[model samples]
Target: MDQAITMNKTSFGTATTGKLGMWLFIVMDGLTFGAILIGGLGLRIGAESWPAAGSVLNVPLTAFNTFLLICSSFTMVMALNSIVRGDQKGLVKYLILTIAGGVLFLCVQVWEYSHFIIGSEHLESILKGAGFTGSQFLPTTGIYGSTFYATTMFHGLHVLSGVIYLSIILSMAFKEKFGPDNYDRVEIAGLFWHFIDLVWILVFTVIYLI
Candidate 1:
């Protein structure tokens, strides 16, 4: 009976092993991001003074980028629905739009990073010109700069990874590899993409908007 039960066991829960593994990975990754953000928040709160995000960063531009990511998440949903409904053309269209959004988001991030971190003027000079200076809130603002760059870059890396993953899935989708009969791969990719979007919402709130 034990051997039979073992042989019959296919899932740890309602999810198959692959799905379960993905969920576990998402959970662990979430915890890692949470730890970093919380530590940054603690440092910010404990500090004597921290620069306002608006003064140090381009809030409006980032807000637009955030909008793009939200739109991408919606397109991803449409793509998944298209596959489930066996609308191959619709799936392809939405998947391409989603990838386009991801690419645009990354491009904007690169521009932002370059504007701040890699320009003709040092970040310190730029910050000083923006009215943030001294030890309180310049480029040399110690923990603030460290935490901000660390968190944003880590999230950017995830965005890059998600784009590559979605692009591969999109290629498979163009070949009609997903349909109602077998769309688990599309669903899995959607899950990861949605997670990336959700994490960005948190990062935008904490790091950019406050």
Candidate 2:
């Protein structure tokens, strides 16, 4: 009698290895961000008084930056859809637009950091005029600064990493590596990009708005 042979599958549920790996990474990364934000909130609650985020940060400008990120997320989805539909040209265009949006967001964030944290001459004068000492708003002076910079800078680094990731994907895309049969790479990249955007929303609401 011949024995029946069985082949072992190497995927989780319906997801392939790469897709399952990306899902695992996103879950772990989400938890990391959640812990940081929750700890920051805990610090804020424990403190007698926390520096008002709106008073020191440019709310309008950051709000606009948030809009740009949201638009980028849409463009990313369009890019993924384009590739899936066999429109390589559309995919490239939308990917470029997404990269542009990410770059613009980083530029605005750099400007905000420079104006408020690094080059604080103007902010100091404004704080003095407002009857509060300059150091009060400085990141080095309190737990508020510590938590704020820690969380924001960490998110910024993730954004920077995402941009670099997208850039590499764009290069491969331009070389025509992605198509209907091989679009899973693009989808994985999109998953990471979307997670970055989602984390920023949480960060904005928790750190800036509240």
Candidate 3:
């Protein structure tokens, strides 16, 4: 019994130092996101002239982006499962898909920001012709604009970082650095990716739908 307790299962799908550290970091980061989101909610709740949902914001575009992010989470899970089954090619394939999802999400988000901040003539014309009202929102626009960009920009940084992290894991995967006996690093990276996706769900609900 003592010997069993002393055994370190680092290579047999057990939590290692890196995994523990990532979980700790995730907890702290989650708290930080919570504080920012709560602060934004407070401001929004107190604002008497808060803009209605879909007024200035393009809800349809953002909803699509949200769906893309959620799909990325699924791909990340698939990547982990593939590696656990000792399928290197499957791991690489899913990781590439997951990374593509993150990249596309960022691109769409940047386009959305441009529409809100710099004002897109083509998009505005289309919306105006369709009888929809569109307004430009910037950090300097007002409290709503400030909080909106702050929350999203913060979350965007996480997505960008997650993409980079996954890219490194992909590189390692190409070198056959992970197998059924050892894939803790990939699992650690997946935890971070999943956390980012979950946070975006909250951000979408609060900042977009609400």
Candidate 4:
């Protein structure tokens, strides 16, 4: 018996659809982040005094956080590979590591927030710490510091939420809910996880490093 099956020039699968949707969200979210980042930069450029991110925030501590996120990305890829290889144990291992990495990253973010104080005090601290003898720094300056705090803190909240979601995904995967035959859900969660990691890369560079 001879049968002929035609393959389409463009074959769209679930992964394609999933990635498309994620990209749409990223585009829209990028616009929002861009506005915030640009506004922060503009205000920073036009300000009398601005706290240098690297100086204020402990780069060593943050570097550890960045490593945590990078490790999570690797763990996510390992999870996907495990699923494709039909190795359930490896899938669980990678997912558990990923979740742990996210948790550790969030903890580092929380620790960073300790350096910040309430309205007037935050400025006082920033000024005093950055070699200011007088009132060189003010919290009311173009709302730059506040906006920076708001945007980055909000992203931290999102990462926390994503970690919770990933934990649930790991729990399900451990129960054998996902395997080689059914791993789209895992991939979808991973897409969001990787997006968080990708977004942090931008945030770290724009907000922290640059």
User: For each candidate, what is the lDDT?
Assistant: 0.83, 0.83, 0.87, 0.73
Looking at model 3, residue 137 earns an lDDT score of 55
Using lDDT as the measure, which candidate wins? 3
- Candidate 2 residue 31 Cα shift, in angstroms, is 0.7
Candidate 1 C-alpha lDDT tens digits along 91-198 = 999999999999999999888877765544455665776555542332454777788888988998998999999999999998998776566788888888999999
TM-score of each: 0.85, 0.88, 0.87, 0.79
lDDT of 3 by residue, 1-210 (tens): 333323424345556789889999999999999999999999978977677777667789989999999999999999999987789999999999999999999999998887776766665664465344454456876787799899999999999999999999999999999887667788999999999999999999888888
**lDDT (0-100) at residue 188 of candidate 2?**
89
lDDT of 4 at 181: 57
**Clashing residue pairs, backbone N/CA/C < 3 A, model 3:** none
List runs of model 4 lying over 4 Å from the truth: 1-19, 118-126, 129-144
Off by over 4 Å in 2: 1-13, 120-122, 125-132, 135-138
Reference-based lDDT, residue 4, model 1: 36
Cα lDDT of model 2 by residue, 101-184, tens digit: 999999998877766655467777656554456634556746777887899889999989999999999999999998765677
- Which of the numbered candidates is closest to the native, going by highest TM-score? 2
**lDDT at position 98, candidate 1:** 95
Flag regions of model 1 displaced more than 4 Å: 1-13, 120-126, 129-141
Model 4 agreement with the true structure over 3-86: per-residue lDDT tens digits: 111111123243467767877886887787778777877877887776667655567777789889999999999998888667
Worst 10 residues of 3 by lDDT: 1-10
TM-score of 4: 0.79
Query: Which pairs clash in the backbone of model 4?
Result: none
